[model samples]
Target: MPLIVLCGLPGSGKSRRAEELREALSAESGGERRVFLVAEVAAGEGGGGGRAALRAEAERLLSRRDVVIVDAGNELKSFRYELYCLSKHTGTPHCLLLCPGGAPRPDRPPLEAPDSRNRWDWPLFTAPEDPSEPLPLPEIRAALFERRPPPPNQSTRSQPLQAAGFLHQLDRLTQDMVAALMAAQRNGVGPGQVIPLAVEGLGQEPPGLLLSRAVSLAELSRLRRQFLSYAKMHPGEGEENLPQLGSMFVQYLNSNLL
Candidate 1:
């Protein structure tokens, strides 16, 4: 499954755009998939903590399905990156659907003071301000909400091994597969082409009949290595990279797992 994170500031129409995306995806896919719209309010007792809480909630929600749309005011680069990482760590494809608004300060009101007593949620402290622009609220909102076909090379359905329990399953499965591949390699098989043999033993069939697609043994090995590398290199990065890496791993598994 792939996760789409809608990023914008308050009054950026993220909610409306998210709904439109959900409807379009469902209609195109025969209305068989589940799309989650996770929303959050930043006005609670804990101001900036709401963002962290939203990230946690998004992570937990990801375990439930393949297509999740996070509706939030993601104005910070760090936050967007975190969403990407979460998708990668969970083995789900992740994309940033950004809504660039023209408001001087999309996240905050133009006339508001830093210490203003407005009870509404304040925009991110780091949001950029551009004074020369006229807000493109309608244009951006229309573009964001309009229904469109899936991007080139994107899968129509969620990939397998993306569930909450996938990590444990993959850990055990990868150990066995590696062991089998190593055994084969020891018997004179090339190390550069070991994933096909491993794929033969995966219990679950690859999603969208990916296994049936034409693929070379060398390509399979490369993909396998990519997956391993993503898992190993991800922890060193910030939380934002997790979803991106997780999604990439899931795509690899979905395309190679037999």
Candidate 2:
């Protein structure tokens, strides 16, 4: 079972989809295999320490499960790539499930979390993956401790923290990282599968609506249409009818990551 890295912005239904995928995979496995969902939000500490803890826990969980679904925003390319490297180090097949949400709205502001030094986010795990073989833990440790080279230029050495400035920076970073992933995909060195899913009406109702009173009826109505369309596309068992979505997931898994 591969480590399925859930990628998307906040409120893109990653956790919900993770549950659906877990159920689908387990059912296919005859209900005997265990699938664990490790949410980055639950990682709590913020910054590298938080990420390190999350990865450590994921590694531990992987040891005892048939599949491990890492549910996180993973908004940065470097972070996603770092995960790819970790999966390689552990000799586990890894893939990405890209979940893009609706257009960003000013009313729906992102959390103002502490900024992570992109260059140092994963100081201990910076190497790229070798799909053919996993590296030895001793060598990985040595690489982590060894001095790293300076950045090729100064721009990447620092970034502005203003809200607008940061969002633009994030946009550029995501674009670059996605392009790299696509290149790697073509080269047979990227994720096993880059599943693209656009989830509509994310902020309109139910969980989101309850949390945010700012959501207007118009927004809610629009969201309902989106959900209905999605549901129509995917009919499944139970109230959520997520099996349809699960079917799409399984179909993607069948494709070669290369």
lDDT of all the models against the reference?
0.47, 0.44
- List ranges where model 1 is wrong by over 4 Å: 42-46, 102-258
Which candidate wins on lDDT? Answer: 1
Q: Indicate the TM-score of model 1.
A: 0.41
Put down candidate 1 lDDT per residue, 124-224, tens digits, no spaces.
12122343333333343343334232233213234343432344444444445445544555565542343343243243442111232334456556655
Please give the range of 10 consecutive residues that has the lowest summed lDDT in model 1.
115-124
- Give the range of the ten consecutive residues with the poorest summed lDDT in model 2: 205-214
TM-score versus the correct structure, for each prediction? 0.41, 0.39
- With candidate 2 superimposed using the best TM-score fit, by how many Å does residue 167's alpha carbon deviate from the native? 33
lDDT (C-alpha) at residue 117 in model 2: 34
